[model samples]
Target: MTTNLTQHFLLDPEVVFLNHGSFGACPRPVFEDYQRWQLKLERQPVEFLDSRRGLAANLRVARTALAAELGTDADSLAQVTNATTGLNIALQSLPLKPGDEILTTNHEYSALEKTLLFIARRTGAKIVTVEIALPLNSAEAFHDAVLAGFTDRTRLLFLSHITSPTALLFPIERLVAEARQRGIWSVIDGAHTPGHIPLDLDALGADFYSGNCHKWLMSPKGSAFLHVRPEWQAMIDPLVISHGWTADNKEPGVRGPFGASAFVDEVEMQGTRDPSPWLAVPSALAFRRDHDWWQVAAECSRLAQETAARVRDLFGLPALSAPSLSAPQMVAMPIPPCDPIAVHDALLRDYGIEIPVFEWQGHHIARLSCQGYNTREQMDLLVKALGELLGLEQPRRKLGQA
Candidate 1:
């Protein structure tokens, strides 16, 4: 509740950052840790660059810590720059044939949607976007709608664990199980799941999953990961071809002198890049633990519920997801009829509130994310601003109104 604790972030103090779900704000301590790694790299470029051992070792440490947090083995997981890159790798690596179908929800992120479209066009595969109703009434309804999208010809099911535009957490556990039963591959875009919800990759049971640490985990930007089941590993080809493609007659699994297998040699050695963000993941984890993020999340959930109630009361709109179905930490509320862009811009320019507003299936949503730093006063300001701007109470003076 105190600005003292919140001031450690480099976020603009004048703005109320309600959009942590988009890209997370890194803490000062974590930022310092990231810089330390950068400094270390600069101090010994020859020792670090000439030897793959140092980079691999650091990666192994990061992988172990991340795997423990995600409840998966380190061997099946590797760090990537972000979830988008991971999704691209997954889509491009999959062996799709003509007439195959990739079923997804209409609520998917636009970037990943474009990637799927590109794959469909190149491989003659079909991308079927099933409409999942907004102002969702119950968990059963959501599950039924998603399951209805499956078909005999469906080769893959691509879905967002937490949808970007909608900001609703999909019931992926049941879907993953059903997809497995149908012998269909499940590739989940978990970009928003890692820090917001509990994730056990082994227990979640997906063929491929990718998440961004930069968003919720409070890691520096460009920190993300990709997890692939061992069976599908053979089919994956790195997007880049470098030392990983063909090393000079080296034994398998061994980090060959300089260059290696396409998986490790190419992707791992993208060449003279900043590994600071990835290396600072452990520090981010420590920061979360030190701050008691679990309790912080619980508090945020309470605040989110309160904020949602207030917004719904002001607008007379329905809730997007059932209280039990959605993560308590984040809420996507239905906004009364308005231009999403206009409302979004008004909130920022007039009220100094930062949030995401978008139209989903004929309903406009003002998705509000509650992080530890946010206070009830900020939510109240948002409500007041929204009421005045939308003429919910009375016709307030417009921007240019006399």
Candidate 2:
């Protein structure tokens, strides 16, 4: 709030936008860079799309920049449109037979839950969902709960790096390591991890990790990456065949026609779609670096946690987990039992505050996302609106007004 970073974002001034976790609002500089890439592509459509020209090289430059930040080499990653796409590419490529198990948690994003269900229906792989207890006090508790579900038939381990429904940061490093030791393929859905947390994919040692650059990174929408370990890259297949396909693409050390590894080429080059969002990733990284985003993120985390606590206390609900276990910028504050749809609509319609209010696991939750552009005043407005709309009795002075 003190830094006054709101001016850099492209959000509408009238509405209080607290839903950065849903689909991120791109910064002005990053948006401009995205437009520039789009314009360049429009000007020379064939040249820009053609790998023989400079498409592959330009994408490599972007990937290398992102890889350096993610603590991995360029060849190990493939730029995808979004995390779901990247996840699907990884999920579909795995060879799951009938009765094989995919171990996950109940806190996964809904789309991915459906994706797993789809994969399960096709391959007859049983999706084993572990229910993590609320008010998580320790990382070891979470680790134990997830690992307990693993069995000899467990062929894959899939879970969110930062859960979408509950917004709790799962202790995945230990689980990933355990899964690897058990010969279980680890596929992580890191949709909210790229800029929200410090990420070192190699050090984490997951066999496959996919994350969105658009969510916490504040890049243009449709920018994300799927990282595969070099040994597993040969088994991973692209979602679409397109021009990048070659006969020996599944074979290791095979280079695509574009000169990069077959994994990068087949996965990245999915035909004539706009690559502007992926290309603009470097600008997003530079914006964060120049703006001292880590300090900003720390401040935002404070604001988000404080706001969540205030809301929870007002509603007389317990905290979801320890502060350290929650995401730095996003928190799912528990609300009193109510119709989530009505509350979500009323907040937007009457209060002009934009935030996600939904029901998860039979509990109503208002998931608040704190970005650099958000203010304490906006949070106050949200709290005030919730109290009034939920019919909570306020003190004599009322809330958010003198």
Candidate 3:
């Protein structure tokens, strides 16, 4: 923590950026590499963007690096703009009929909730949402809550690896396995999980998983990957029809013009787009390796937990979960009754802290994110700012107290 890791990032020095869980801050080296890729593309547009030329081969190299980090085969992964797009591709492709059920939970990201609603309206499929109880203490509690939602009509199960609103980590391994046993397809939204936690997608056994490198991996924005098991890859259709897509895509082992499986080629080869962020992924991985980011992330998790506890005591608020059940580097603390927008604006205006304040399940939440660049002093600053803004002149009840 004494090494001043902030110097390596491109964030503004004036802002105490506690919003890494939102669009992440790219490190200097990775941003430079992203610019380098952009320069290369501009130098020769035809050679860089043409699938028959350097484009396809270059994309494969990036995918290989990401696949190794994700513990999946390169061919099973496809580069997309973000996890939302990836999940859209996976969800819309499913052959949902009238009366089929798409099972999910209450804590899913709002954008995805809209996506699910759209799909349900169009396909006449019903969305069965289960409520995950708060103050989570054990994995069994999560498993029990989710497993009870499954029914014979359930065809697809969608879940967030780390929830957005409450910032709690759902123990999805058991639920995914149970879904598989029930012959239900499992799709995971891993937007906050790529570098925040250790992942082994093949071992996880989810039918489809999508994550954002731009969030936790510290890559440039608009970089993410979707992984599909080989058996299910043929069923995935690209969001856009492009040259790489073929009508005979249902035939297995069919390689596109890029020499990768039809699944990867179709999802990745959309119309002209900047591939710089995707190509810069290897540099982001390298940066993490060189910095020993695992150790830094551990420190960050400790800081996040300690800070959340302090905030909880300040507001007399109960915890959403135990430390083990929460996100490693992001903690959403329940704040005293207040307008979320006013608190959010006051923090930025009165203090230079950048954080997210919103309502979840009728409770106002102040979500804090800790990255390698954050310091103990910054966390203290945030606590001081909140106390003053909310008029918490005296500490309230302790975290576990009723």
Tens-digit per-residue lDDT, 329-374, candidate 2: 9999998777677777778877888888898989789999999999
* lDDT of each residue in 12-129, candidate 3, tens digit only: 9989999999999999999999999999999998889997888898999999999999888999999999999999999999999899999999999999999999999999999999
Tens-digit lDDT track of model 1 for 1-402: 332257668889899989998888899999999999989889987665554548767876887899999998776776789999988888899989999999998989999989999999999999988888766667778788878988888999999998887778788899899999999999999999998887999999899999999988999999998888766765666687654455433233444333332244445566667778998999999998888887788788888888998888887877877776666677888777776777787788988899998887677888888888888888889888878877645433543234
For candidate 2, give the lDDT of residue 14: 84
All candidates' lDDT scores? 0.81, 0.91, 0.91
- Candidate 1 achieves a global lDDT of 0.81
- Regions of candidate 2 where Cα sits further than 4 Å from its true position: 249-252, 393-402
